[model samples]
Target: MAAEQAPSSNDVRTWERIDFHAHLLPDFYQRALTETGEAGPDGMSAAPGWNVQDALSMMDRTGIRFAVLSLSSPGVHFGDDAAARRLARRINEFGAALVTEQPDRFAMLATLPLPDVDGAVAELEYALDVLHLDGVAIETNARGLYPGDDAMRPVFEALEARSALLFLHPTSPPNHGSVSFGRPRPILEFPLETTRAVIDLVLAGTLRRSPRVRVLVPHGGGALAVLADRVATLAPAQMDLGDVDVIAELGALYYDVAGMPVPRQLPALLQLASKDRLLYGSDWPFTPIPIIEAMAAAIGSTDLLTDADREHIGWRNAVTLLPRLAALAH
Candidate 1:
């Protein structure tokens, strides 16, 4: 397929980018937000403006070839299982429609009705088998139930059986009240919760049981990059993997640079995940287009990454995970 029209910026339009951590808000989800008058999921600010045209325009401008869309935080569940199941299907169908409309420009990570284990599995089958999505997007914690919860094992088993591409995103920790000192949840809370979730997931041994599951943690794996030793120290006592190297286990999973890949984040991310495991993400709509473009430039110029490594993170690494996007390589 021909590339989309280029933006005014003449930096270099030679390659296409794959965004592994973008989001979509269905009409129903938006309506719910409107009804509640929410500023967004963290309840701190309004949900960012989102629409396919805006997302695609930004992608074209920024050299992003394809984006894997997922529902943002405060996922499908709101204490009502029926609402969760219905919304999951509705939102997924909305995403599938986009892929159908523009196969090259859009693909989706199906949202699940999680913490409702059976509902999640059922949604997974429908989304994958029928809708043919790229994979599923799971929150770090679904309805306050982190990935490690035993109750969600069957769902993980189903995903593992398929060797699924599971994208893990952070949700606000349940102890929001205690942490808030007039600061929004995204500040220190988001990364801390993400760190806790990843560690807990590892401790639960979900990865061991689902060895084939290809996992991608967003925001450069949150604080997990520098927390390896802390995790390693705790792992031996927290879970019974007699002689396993905790760092190795953490390294095996993939991570995306959605937010700015600043100085502190770059080293740890590169050290933890090899070139092939680091993918690009804009966190579009939530992250302003200008910021995403700046992130791309910053990451592109950083000496910490060789040209080849940056190339893989920007576009090539994703081909291995979702072959459909590989067409761009030609």
Candidate 2:
């Protein structure tokens, strides 16, 4: 792989943003979706066609310097733990190889075979230590089990030990009837599910127990900004929170402005967390390039966030989270 030339001062006008929530659809992952015969498992009408070249073109056009890749919805395991394990390893190897080649353009959050506790743990160990991935991307709920479930404690413990970066991606909610009331899932259910999972993690004391784990949540933390007060009020009484400050903990975690970052979403997120807590994301492949470009334009036009705020969310905060990006920032 050829080294990307350091951007000229004028080139900064292009994609200087660091995308924390981009995805990679490995051929095997696409095969899984095809084999299942599911039409847009993420609630879209059908799966979007994706390839490395397409992603690169979109990134270059939109001013994204580096995109941290993760597998999107329906994650690694599709009701088969063993198959998921193999797929996870293959995906990790593929992503690691890409990072090795680009080093500047891409980094990856390893996909683990979750809801398969032992396999997840083993994969996490190898992906982080051996493959040298930046971190792991996890579903809000894994195979009908939320990340906060006591069953996944060992995995959380391992993440805490490594102080790993955990990027939480929302999944299709199980039993999606009412939420699906002829409405698109990403329009309603996706953000709502992310809210539910984060609530579980907070109320279940998972965040409290795993203090060292730096979490990165997408879609500006979904519904968290809207529901912050409710969870803040109820969590302490319902859970054994000890001395932990619920609001502070939530504020400390990272959120990415991947979807429609303006209007109500960004403002609400700002109220919940400091500006530094926010990161930029494009949601490429799944999100059309036009929408991503629109998001960038919106951010540029917005009066709510200052120049410093834009800089932080664009890539500064992300570089702070993953230092290797700093070297590539030029």
- Measured by lDDT, the strongest candidate is 2
Question: Per-residue error at 273 for model 2, in Å?
Answer: 0.6
- The estimated TM-scores of all candidates read 0.93, 0.93
Q: What TM value does model 2 have?
A: 0.93
Residue-by-residue lDDT tens digits, candidate 1, 1-330:
999976533242444678888999766788876664454668567778778888888888888888889998878887779888998999999999999998988889999998899999999999998999989998888768888889888888888888899998887888787876757777677778888888887777777778998998888888888888887887688668777777887889998988876777988877787878999998888788778877887777678877777678878889898887878774
What candidate 2 gets wrong by more than 4 Å, as runs, is 1-15, 237-240
Off by over 4 Å in 1: 1-15, 36-39, 237-239
Q: Residue 222 error for model 2, in Å? A: 1.1
User: Tens digit of lDDT per residue, candidate 2, span 33-152?
Assistant: 888765477667877787788888888887888889999888878788898899999999999999998888899999999989999999999999999999999998887888999998
lDDT of each: 0.83, 0.86
Worst 10 residues of 2 by lDDT: 7-16
